[model samples]
Target: MEASSNFLKRSGFLTLLMIFVLCCSKEVNIPEPVQAYEPHTSKIREILFIGNSFTSFNLGISYHLNLYLANDSLSYKPLIQEAAFSGYSLAVHLTNEQTLAKLNERSWDVIILQENTDIAVNDTMATLESIKAFQELVGNKGTLIYLLMSWPYKDQPEMLIPIIKTFEEGSQAIGATIIPVGEVWTAINQDGNPNIDLYNADGMHPSLQGTFLAASMCYSHIYNQNPSENPYLAGLENTTALYLKQKAN
Candidate 1:
């Protein structure tokens, strides 16, 4: 009887071990997630946003960007907080030691800059010249430059055409990408948002909804992800679609 009991106990232990081994042996393959953009080969070092009132839309675009990125994170890019101010001249930004200190202290992976609205629109050679100087000063080590294109002035929408063209040229000169936030807004604003204001009360800055839209557009490109994949895009798409429909009506 003792021998029989020992045999049974040993057999039970062997069965358990076999089961555990089997569980560990075969691996289940999880579908590699498809990113809207290819897996980021490089991590984003830092993102510096420089613009006048439009870029500074203060807790507007930046806030909404964080909200979307924080909640629905499906990208491989590192978190890069924005550093900028409203009505900031390119020359002033270049001369500002504090601003330079931030870049010098940390290696920025990307810089999305926007010249002041007037400077960008007024055909000011100085603005572009300052940008050239600033670019050189930053020592273009491993940074990607980009221009943030803002929306048309509600009162003078035509004034934006030249500016947009010029910005494209400037971006070409600097080897930077362009985030056409203004065009995105124009597409969305065709529909009347009865109570929801798209631009700020001043009609120059972006309203809450406007900021969210800008954030969504920029985030989509920067992270190489599509907004359709983004959860927030649903709302934005719905709003834009409705706007288009209303235009048809």
Candidate 2:
């Protein structure tokens, strides 16, 4: 009887030991999500920015783009290449040496041009002249895209609505693409989501969420991604990729 009891205890201990060993052997740990990336060259040859405080946006939009480039795990990081700044219009920046330096530095891959939200008002000619003058300096190889920055005027979308055609005209004339963030915001605003705050304290500049939306849109277009479906723009990417591919052929 004692031998039988000893055998049972020994078996039980072995079973427990096997369980412990199995537990220690390995755990099916899911890998962490890989850091975001794009299939672009390691060095960002050049990029230039011209726009309003909206384009500058507490500089959040620009910084977020840089962050996306810097954090990418690929061997090559997307560098700034070059940058220029102006408020409200391109007129000031185009005249400045900084704009020339940025343009002259390299055959830029992209040039970001943005106009003030109130282009329907005064000094729009100044904005247009800047774009025209800068285009002369902007080398032929780079793709220019007009950033259609959205206003945070959640209450008065009407005041902000007229700028759409202005952006489209800029895009058509300059052979540039439009970011169309205003369209995105207009659609979102129409949904009447009470939970989302689209504007900053002044009710003009986008808040963080608005910035995220803009950044996501920029990210989507630049990387050939979509913003809505894939959660952080997974679905949008494929659609753009396919579209670009089809267009190329």
Candidate 3:
């Protein structure tokens, strides 16, 4: 009788312990599954611009591009970001920690690389090497790489020849698309619109019109659509904006 009673007590305790454990488990909250970090929604296209002052001047190309996109009735939205600094070349970017961090921050849909104007003209080999390095880093992420061709100085029109050649060679060597911004600027110059000035007083940096033109060209090539179609004037006069869009198209 004593053994049977002890057995029953032990069984009762064991059952009680299990019940307590089960109750505790039911009361405790289990965490939901962790999701990966996504910077933008699937409906948004992210573009990262890596360049120098030419890219950042006048609030940057991405700024105007966003303005154009915002005014359009497109299916997908665009989110543009930049890691541009004054006088920073592709070679300099490779060595800079901040630039490296920005490059690896996210899987961008498109990465636009603009080399320093002087490096592209004088050191084509270096430019190609930097482009190759960037290509390797980008890998097969389905990200499109493009070179934003820099325009010639306002006073030195002859510089455009070598600059164009360098960008062409770099694009061909790396299998990247060329934005041809410089070419567009050259065409605009030939058009002889005194109302449109592409260069800042320094003759190196781009003026507001130059930046608008660059942004328009970028919009045209990146979207495979005509910039003239987009009604965003980017704060410019209607006639001037229309003229720039026509040239970009």
Candidate 4:
């Protein structure tokens, strides 16, 4: 009987030990499987900006474009250069020696043409002719040509209508893509009196916010992605940047 009792105690102790071991195993923290590290496949694209002060102001649209590309996780690394002259029209660029030189400098993957706001609105035919000429310069090199539709003067809100019409007409005529930046500006302005002004003091050129918004639109159109996803603020307040992105989208 004593031997039987000893066996029972031993069995109980072993069972307790097994239960304790199982309980400890359940409490043990197992690490999750590590994901494989995948490197970004880097691609460099040469982009040329041919426009006026609207494209060059606030350190140029290309500058902000590069910033967005650099900050984003995308594989594209932009080699951006601009031939921007203040208050110059696309017609003037067609004749300018520097502009001609830049066109021949290299084969650009993309060329963005931003016409002077006044010229685009007032001389629509002239703007269309210049766009055609620029396209000819780009040649059949498979270079994607895009028109950067600029915004109207802050006080002269009526300019937006003609500007949009001109750009849309030019895009159809020249087979170039329209960035529709002016439309985005108009939408934001009409939505409400936004906290961030889209115009500079001259009520013509873009403010920093305006430039950022333009850049966001460019990035969205070119990359075929949502600009709101990009984290680069371009020195604007977070909320302002977000507003511009959402509006651009």
Candidate 5:
């Protein structure tokens, strides 16, 4: 009888021990969501920017883009043009004569497309239709098109979801690459490292810091180089620039 009792207790202890080991193993091997990336060595030169105030605001993305490339030691530089309109949506740009005229006027190596912030979030169909229209307009051209995903409003953080989705859908539909600037902004805010203000007082336009971050990511994506390696600060402190560069990746 004593032997039987001892055997039962030993079995119970072994079972508990096995459960503990299994739990620990699972904890140690927790799985995380996989991220898909496309790393390329393509060099972009002779670019054009088209969109609303996001592309045309405060020296605009093109201005800092040149600064970033010019500062890089790798010797890649491009003539950048800004053909952005204030408060314009992709839908509006689709019909705008100036945008079309610019496309027809020059042989561009790449065209950076940015949609209005609210339109991208609230009206995805418009975004998609506009992208389709642009693709059709630029048909058969060797110029590469890149979607510059705009960020959400400062107060409306959830606005990011649809904006990102629209950009992703548009890029996939047109077979273009996305600069993912909006996604990077979301990440920067979530990571909270240095916690820099990416917006101007209006909470819509990008401040200098915001433009620097966007420019850094654009430079990194277009040149296929690590943003952290670039020495341009856009007059920002080294620490701030380093943090933005790391977040761009």
Candidate 6:
């Protein structure tokens, strides 16, 4: 009877070990998880511009960007949506229901924001508040936001100091990136570049050359590509285009 009991216990233990080994040895086919598409790629598909004439002037930001990209022989062509109104402040956009609605209208890869040129200097708090609100509204939607730091008035170059400060504060507060267009203009001016005039007759809006520079900056930021390689001239002389593109890069 003792021998039979020992035999039974040994048999049971062997069976259990065999079962565990069998279970562990078999390959379990867990499907590899599908990767989500990233929006920030070498090929940016959609962009939403939210601002005033600073973004839409001189045949529009969209036009110049597309022209540059297409001329560069890129595989992807971007679809740009502009929600810009001339002379509108960030406060106006905050109160405008249409602007809020437009945020949900599409899946934008990038949303570029340009405030009224003077608002950042004159009313920094209001500008910062609106930027914060917009950033919150657009942040979670999987879109990158960029602040276009426009140039100060031509006559009042001193205004740039405060304006740059305001944009810096606003961008830090909201975690948005800034495209330093104003800084670029300042550099060109301080360097004594005789060929580049970035402003229109109003001294606020950009000239065709200014728009080209702005567009190149936008393109570079969005696509992660160098702007100098682009072939689109935007009617600018080759030397001027090359200079602007180099600065934009």
In lDDT terms, which candidate is top?
Answer: 3
**Candidate 2: tens digits of C-alpha lDDT, residues 117-224:** 665333456555666666777646655555555453666777554566666556666666777777667776676756555578877777766666666666567656
| Pairs that clash in candidate 6 | none
Identify the leading candidate in terms of TM-score: 4
lDDT of 5 by residue, 1-249 (tens): 999999999999999999999987784655887854333334666898998888877798899888776765434446888889999987887778898888887778888999888888888898989888888877677888899999988889899889889999998898989999888888788877655989899998998888888888888777777877666788888888888888886
lDDT of 3 by residue, 1-249 (tens): 999999999999999999999988786677999864322223438999999999999999999988877777556767799999999999999999998898888887889999999998899999999999998888777778999999888887888999989999988987899999898898888989878988999988999999999999888888766777677887899999999999888
Flag regions of model 2 displaced more than 4 Å: 1-45, 81-86, 120-126, 141-143, 227-249
- List candidate 5 segments past 4 Å from native: 1-43, 73-77
Model 6 backbone overlap count: 0
Clashing pairs in 4: none
Reference-based lDDT, residue 219, model 1: 70
Worst 10-residue lDDT window for candidate 1 reads 240-249
lDDT of 6 at 206: 91
Question: Candidate 3 or 4, higher TM-score?
Answer: 4
Error of 6 at 4 (Å): 99
Q: Give per-residue CA lDDT, model 6, range 146-229, as digits (tens).
A: 899989888889989988999999889878889999998888878778888888998888999989999999888777767776
The model with the greater TM-score, 5 or 6, is 6
Q: State each candidate's clash count.
A: 1, 5, 0, 0, 0, 0
What's the distance in Å from true for residue 73, model 2?
A: 2.1
How does each model score on TM-score?
A: 0.70, 0.66, 0.80, 0.84, 0.79, 0.79
Worst 10 residues of 3 by lDDT: 35-44
lDDT of 1 by residue, 147-205 (tens): 77777777777767877876777776767688877666675566456644567778887
Which stretches in model 1 have alpha-carbon errors above 4 Å?
Answer: 1-42, 58-60, 72-77, 191-196, 232-249
**In terms of lDDT, which candidate is stronger, 1 or 5?**
5
Instruction: Locate the minimum summed-lDDT window of 10 residues in model 4.
Output: 35-44
Query: Each model's RMSD to truth, in Å?
Result: 9.7, 8.4, 17.9, 3.5, 13.5, 15.1
